[model samples]
Target: MIDLLEIPGFVLDDEREELLAELRAIPGTAATVLSQDMGGRVQPNVRKTTRLAVSPETRERVKEWLMDAKDVLAARFGVALGDCEDPQFLRYEEGDFFVPHQDGNTPLVHDASRFRRVSTVIFLNERSGEPRQGAYGGGPLVLHGHYRTHPGLRVEAPADPGTLVAFRSETTHEVTPVTHGVRYTIACFFRAADAP
Candidate 1:
C-alpha cells in the first residue's frame, strides 16, 4: 500500500498562529474544481469550502515555505519536481467536505493541473472527535490506495497542527465532512521543473 509522507510541525506554532489570524481577518470566496472543458468552476457537490484571498505577501511567504518541501517530496516520491504553485488557504466549517478525487495528472483533465506531480496539505489546527478549543471534529483526510495494488485500503491522515502531508497528485483522496468547529489548511501543487 502506498503511504503518504507526513512531516510533523511543517509550520511552526508562531507561524501557524499568525497565518490563522491573517486568514480569519479576510473574507473568502467559494472554492472551485478544475473542469476539463471550462476550467475552474464551483461545484458544491464535489467540494464545499471557502478559499481565502490571502494578501500577496502572505502568498509569497507561503509559497516559499511550500517550496522548501519540494526536495523532500521529490526524494520521497521519486519524482522530479520544479516549481511550487501558489498555495490555497482553505477553510472548512461544519458540513464542508471534498469527495474522493485526484489532484492531477489524470486523463480526465487537460488543464494546467495535468502538470501537477505532487500535492501537499498543511493542517492549521488539531482534530478532535468532540468539540474542543482550537480543534475540529470529523474532517479526516482519507487517502485511498491504488485500486490495482491495495484496493479498499484507506488511510486517515493525521490532523495535528502544523503537520504537512504530501502525496502523488494522482492519488485518490477526500476530506470527510466536518462535524464541528473549523478546519483550516493550505493546499498546494508542485510541477516538474521542465513542465511547460
Candidate 2:
C-alpha cells in the first residue's frame, strides 16, 4: 500500500528554500537525465527530470531521516526495511514526466544491494508557486494500487513541502508532467536486508 505522511517541520521553511536554491544552482550537465523505463534509456518526452547532486552532509542527514521513516513505517505498517541508498535530488520542470514503473521484484538478483524493497520520496517544494500548497503545477506523485477485487485504483499524492510518501518498491507509480514551475523532490530506495 502507498503511504502519505506528514512530518511536521521535517524541513523548516528556511531549510527548504536553502536546499531548493542549492538544487537549482546545479548546472544542467551535472544533473543526470531521468529515464522512463528501467532499461536506463533517457526518453525526455516520456520521462523528464534532472537528478541533482547533494553534499555529503546532506546525504548523511537524508539517510538518517530514511532510517527514522523506516521506524515509523515498521511501527504503523509492520514493514521492515534495511539500508538505504544515497538520496537522489530531482528537479522536474515544465513538461517533465515519468511513466509508470516498479522499482523491484521479490526475486533477488546477483547483487543484493540493487534490490529496492521500499521507495520513498520527499516533496521539497510547492506546485508552481501555489501559495500554501506545493511548488509547481501539474506534477503529482501518482501511486497505482492493486486489490484482489479492484483494479486501476490510484492515489495522487500532492507535492506539499515536508511531505513524505513511501510505498512498496514493487508498486507501480509515476509523476505527471509538470505544466508550470519547478517541482523539487528527494527520492531514495531501501533494501529489505534482513529478508533472504
Candidate 3:
C-alpha cells in the first residue's frame, strides 16, 4: 500500500546514508558552470554525476533503488512501471550552488526529446555545517514564480538529510550558493515515453 498521488517525500533511510558516505570517496570531477535558463545550468562545487558512468557495485545499488522506488510510486499512482532509468548522484563541495532556471529540454530529435516529466531529488546528507547561514546568506532551492502564473515556479528544498522532493520537470528551480559546506544527493528524472 504505497501512497503516491502527487509529490511525496520518501526517505531511503536503510542504506541511503551508508551508500552516500561510500560514494563520497569514489572521486569526483570539477563541474562546469553552465549558463542559466529554463534549461537549468551553472552549478559549482559539483563533482561527478552517476548518470554518466558508475562502478559496478554503485550502479547496481542505484538501479535497484530507483526501480524499487518507481514501483512503489507507480502502483500508488495507478500507473504501470513502464520503464526504469539510472539514478543520478550529485556532490557539491563548500560554496557550491546553482542559479535559478527551468530544466532544459532533453537533446531532442524531431522535438520529441521534451519527454522528461518528473524530477525527483533524494537528499543524501549534508557534510556542511551551520543549520542556517548567517545574516549574509546560504543555499536554497529557488523556483521563480508565485503571485501571477509566471513562466516558472520556485520551491526551496530542505537542507536536511533524507529529504526527497519530486516535481514536474517543466517547473523551474535551483540550489542557491552554499555559504558553508558540501551538499550531496541522488536525483532521477522520469518520463512517460522514450527520451527524444
Candidate 4:
C-alpha cells in the first residue's frame, strides 16, 4: 500500500477562516510546472490552478507549522527531513485540475524540486459531493500506488478542512478537476536534511 500521513485539525478552524479570508483578497498567478531544462513554466493542461501570492510573513508562519511536524514526518517515513520550502497558497476554481504527476525526487525532474523529500497539502475547506456553503466538489487528492506492483491502485485522500496530508516526494498523485465551487489549499515540500 502507498504510505501517507494524515493529520486532522492541523490548522484550527478560527485560524483557517482568517487565512482563507486573507488569501481570497489577493490576486493569483497561474501555477507552474518545473521542467528539467526549462525552469518553471505554466502548462495549463498539466497543472491548472492559481498560485496566490501570500505575504512573506504568512509564508513564514505556515513554514513554521510545517517544520513543527518534521519529526513526526521523519519517523513516519523513515527519512530525515530538514526545512520546508515556502508554502504555496493555491486556489482551484471550477474546471481547474492537475493531471497525474510526481512531486519530486524522481528522474523526471532535475530542478531544485529534486531535493524535495516529502510533499504535503493542507486543505483549507471541506469537500462535498453536492454544492454547499464553504465546501467544494470533484477536487480530490488522489495518490497512486507503485506502477510495477499495483498499477490500478488509486487512493482518494481525505479532504476535511484543516487536514494535512503528506507522502513521499516520488509518489505519483494528482488533484482531480473541480466541478463546482472553489478549492483552497496550502502546499509545500520538505527537503532532505543533508541536501545541499
- Residues 2-96, candidate 1, lDDT per residue (tens digit)? 65899999999999999999988889989998532327889999999999999999999999998887888999999899997778899999999
Candidate 1 global TM-score: 0.95
Q: What 10-residue stretch in candidate 2 is worst by lDDT?
A: 29-38
Report lDDT (CA) for all predictions: 0.90, 0.70, 0.53, 0.91
Between which residue pairs do clashes occur in model 4?
Answer: none
lDDT of 3 by residue, 1-196 (tens): 1111333335556676666657656775544332121233434334222222347688677766666667656555444434434565666554666555444334432232255555567766653445542111355555555335654444455545666665555555777675655566666666554443
Model 1 segments more than 4 A misplaced:
35-38
The sequence of per-residue lDDT tens digits that candidate 2 reaches over residues 63-165 is: 8877877777655545667777778788887788888866674455334434667777888886653523435888888988764533578888755687777
- The TM-score between candidate 4 and the true structure equals 0.96
Q: Model 4: per-residue lDDT, tens digit, 137-175?
A: 999999999999989999999889999999999999999
Better of 2 and 3 by lDDT: 2
lDDT of 2 at 85: 72
Indicate whether candidate 1 or candidate 4 has the larger TM-score: 4
Give me the candidate number with maximum TM-score. 4
Clashes of 1: 0
Clashes of each: 0, 10, 6, 0
Report the number of backbone clashes for model 3.
6
lDDT of 1: 0.90
